[model samples]
Target: MGSKPRILVARAIFPDIVERLRTHFEVEDNPGDGIWTPDALAARLADKDGAFTTGSERIDAAVLAAAPRLRIVANMAVGYNNFEVDAMTAAGVQGTNTPDVLTETTADFGFALLMATARRMAESERYLRAGLWTQWSYDMFAGGDIHGSTLGIIGMGRIGQGIARRGAHGFGMKVIYHNRSRLGAKLEAECKARHVGKEELLRTADHVVLVLPYTPAAHHTIGAAELALMKPTATLVNIARGGIVDDAALAVALRERRIAAAGLDVFEGEPRVHPDLLTVPNMVLTPHIASASVPTRRAMASLAADNLIAFFDGRGPLTPVNRPVAHPRGY
Candidate 1:
């Protein structure tokens, strides 16, 4: 039998997936799902040829320098902001991310968060659970309407389009979106969405959802100034990565009622949320599970596994985030 490549499963994944990887490579599986420090991760990766990672892991120049044997890092999430692409390319390392598979699922969660926020569902639930719902009152948890309201989406990618369709068709909402580039006229008509400038979308939207990717440029895409642009009665929902919205600034806005309510599935420093957000009654917080549906999560894991398998089998990686310099020495 030919020698198999050594691979590291950086975080815990399905046992069946681990077995599948074992068939092709010598697998070092972390079934406990321990959160590894950067130093720990680099040390572990030192002897490995490839790794299966998630958004939680930061693969950068320092880490790459420590892992000379590492050639590929397959991230199981659509966002690869945790990866330093330029560093990986310089180190001749291939990086891949799971995209498209989780788009619809994530969009579903985004709308779900929007609905929950606008309707004051979480706040009402807390009131009920706390035994505070003594009598029926008209103003008790009165919230913004969803149907026929304007929906603004930032970052009009596949997931953004999915959210637009959900709002326009499913809820009879008017959709406006801002992206780096506008969508084709045909797609715009199909989604029942209008292309708008970012400032316009922020100022006019009754409900604004962030679906943009996280980059250095995208950091704090929504800050105090942008929050100030939103209507006092508008709702904000973020299903995008943390740091895209300044969490501390958002918490202050939510506390001051700069916006009516906010729903977040991701945070700047999650699984640790901003303490100020927790104190705000109008805010709804969820652990980063926008694409946490069973079928979709499984599909994402499957795709990451497929990318790893395909890459080591002498085929080019699927969903490559960077084009690595081809090295004569095999990984």
Candidate 2:
């Protein structure tokens, strides 16, 4: 067999993972955990056959043109927007993403964010910290309940399905979802979910969680119009990609109490959140760490590593984003 192909890992990862890649490829890992600019990435990828990447690493048209030898990019995150997929396809490069493995973990986080927001958990904690909790009152931080409430999910993918099942079966909540296509009757029956039009989902739900993929067409899927449709007491949660919601508009809605509150784990132009969002009292904010459980993150890394190993071994990638271009440069 030819010598092992060269691969560069764009960010610092588990050393054991580096060792695993070292076994199959000439691995150049970022030991100091420095963020690579696009030019630096292009320079390193020029001679490598593949790369292991995270969402922050952008492999755009310029990088693709510079790295003619690049065959595959295995992204640790489920979203692959960092990749210029069309440009990569045109340049004969493959892309893989880590999914399924992080579904339950991410769903757990989404639900947690929702509960925190609805219950005014963060704001309440801050109140106590500021010595403002002198005594409990009947209406002190009164918030909505998850039980028997309508839970709306946008995007019916695996993670979204996990959330639906939890809301319907566990919380005794009514589950409604909106997706590009309808789920089969059998699956819907199992989750006790009803598929509805986007507008109806927004207006009727007590809680709305966004889990849809990001694309130009899906930009601002929830914006001024949709936010205006939501109930004044509704809570919104987003664990999906940034840009899926109009951050500025949502911040405005929250500040004015147009909607009850928002729980956000991702934001537009992250890791910088909109200043307006920061000023809102009813909103709960977190860094983009929905899939950050130790075990789950390890699973994601291992799955991405497995994709790299499988691709380089002449077997197809384990979870390819685009099947036809799964191994463009060949083994």
Candidate 3:
């Protein structure tokens, strides 16, 4: 207890945040931001009491076994899908995540992606850049309208509610949402969103947006069948985690014009997108950056750092995704 707690920051973060951690702990940080495989991550974690991990790091049972001294992991993301949460808890290791900080920023990016997809902005940009615009035709680059249209949102969490508020209030959209549990009456009225079944939302909405979390049950929430249900003029936007949509199936749907277009910020096994999606002109793809605003990202890192500091200081975790016994501070 006399020596400072030794911690590893698994990914490159702001130097200021690292320095803050250093003030309270023996800090080892990644300045180059290199990706670490599970074995590598375990090796680095071997002697540490705590770790600051990003979404890409896999903290599984095997990794946990290798790091017997490790007790807490602070994840710099809203989604703890990267963590084997059950295993961490079983091993008496606390896991925490950054939430609420990036909700509005992510919602903004989701809407922007939806607008770009519906308006054919990216496709048109490619055409112009390639010098393929010989003449302006009345129907040239004409795309669907967003205003006063129906908006379908899957997984109505905080960020999803923000997106719903934007569509319902800002765009005058009739918002319908599908979630594991329906929002309360007041919450629904506040966002002007209606609770609906998944199939109905897919069949009828003018634009469908995915804001769901990643889990085994949520894997491939939108696949070939769901895509086929959508109107041929409909648009699909995913700002959610990868594996929510079957990327290969989406590629085929876009290639066949089954759906008018899709804008994806996350993909299955990205930043390696499906080869077929690349060939489809009706798709807009982005790296997973929905929560990428400068201030928001820094806030996320700050919260993650806060979790590590708070737990070790006996104040308990700020936002723990799992409850592990043996809190050194006795929560």
Worst 10 residues of 2 by lDDT: 322-331
How far residue 172's Cα lies from its native spot in candidate 3, in Å, is: 0.7
Assess every candidate by TM-score: 0.98, 0.97, 0.98
In the range 61-138, model 3's lDDT, one tens digit per residue, is 999999998999999999989899999999999999999999999999999999999999999999999999999899
* Residue-level lDDT tens digits of model 1 in 1-331: 3468888998988889889999988999899999899999999999988999998899999999999988899999999988999999988899999999999999999999999999999999999999988899879999999999999999999999999999999999999999999999999998999999999999999999999999899999999999999999999999999999999999899889899999999999788888898999999899999999989988999999998888887677888999843422453
lDDT of 2 by residue, 197-223 (tens): 999999999999999999999899999
lDDT by candidate, in order shown: 0.92, 0.92, 0.94
Whole-structure CA lDDT of model 1: 0.92
Off by over 4 Å in 2: 326-331
The model with the greatest lDDT is 3
Model 2 CA lDDT for position 152? 97
Better of 1 and 2 by TM-score: 1
Ranking of all predicted structures according to lDDT, beginning with the best and ending with the worst: 3, 1, 2
